[model samples]
Target: MERLNKPLTTRQERFCQSFVIYGSGAVAARAAGYKARSSNRQGWRLLQSVRVRERIREIQASLADHRGRANDVIIGKLEMVYHRAMENYQYHAAARAAQMQAKLFQGIEETRAELAAAGIGRDDEDRDRETPNNSPELAGPKMMTFDDNSREIDKACTQMSTWKKRV
Candidate 1:
């Protein structure tokens, strides 16, 4: 007697090949002259026989192993990219903060020179004539503004420290 589960015929072979290549089982079944679309279910069941199932399982296992190795490579590459991007961000942030600090210092120095030129001090050698309650009470507002700016810088530095730790 002929086996009920024999391999596919030439027409069925063409159907399976077209289905796999084009990802359309209906089209494949129509191309194979299967009048009913339900014939695709029969084709699928035949393909899932014991021997075919074992072969499919083995192929899938091999593909999965290869995919695991490829995933490790991809993760390593992505981690390096993340590290480099973080380094660039940190470098630019530090440079910008340094530039701002330098500008603030320049402003302070200019205020000092102005105070010296005005000669409004108890002592000629006193460089801190801008201090509150010191000679030249007019420097109070400028000194208070500078102190506020310094506090803002300190707060910014603290925030950066916290953010760096989290990152």
Candidate 2:
């Protein structure tokens, strides 16, 4: 329901923060103290509220901006380290710093290229996607979590072990 500039209640505020953290509506609702059984329903209802939606968007936008700023800060510090290492005749440290800088820039460039290929304008998308931590930027080995039949695998393994022992 849309209301005229309604301020979010404390629980609503907590829900926004938790939603951002977990990226799950039901989980966020539970974290915000909603009844466990009704958390999913409450989360859906909260998302329907215009005010709540706006707050979530605002929170996400701020985090995106902060992430971008953080990357810039990191690059700047790396540059300083590179210069200092070179001045101190620490060739190894200087080379390491240069390598890190190259990797960081390469990641950023890859993300930009991906965005372009996907038809996302540099200025139009959220800044977070351009950072090195983002998958397109990281472009290397990644660990994936899969929810497979682990219990069944365990059972099968145990049965196989027992059969081998008997044989």
Q: Which one is best on TM-score?
A: 2
User: Number of clashing residue pairs in every model?
Assistant: 0, 0
Candidate 2 residue 137 C-alpha distance from true site, Å: 18
Ten-residue segment with the worst summed lDDT in candidate 1? 139-148
> Please, what are the lDDT tens digits per residue for candidate 2 over residues 1-167?
46748789999999999887666789999999999999999999988888888899999778656645455545655666666665675555655666676688678779879989999886734444444675554532221111232333344445545663444
- Residue-level lDDT tens digits of model 1 in 80-119: 3333433555533443444444565576568778877899
Q: What is the lDDT of candidate 2?
A: 0.69
For candidate 1, what is the lDDT?
0.50
Candidate 2 TM-score to native: 0.45
Clashes of 1: 0
Candidate 2: where is the Cα deviation over 4 Å? 69-106, 109-167
What does candidate 1 score on TM?
0.24
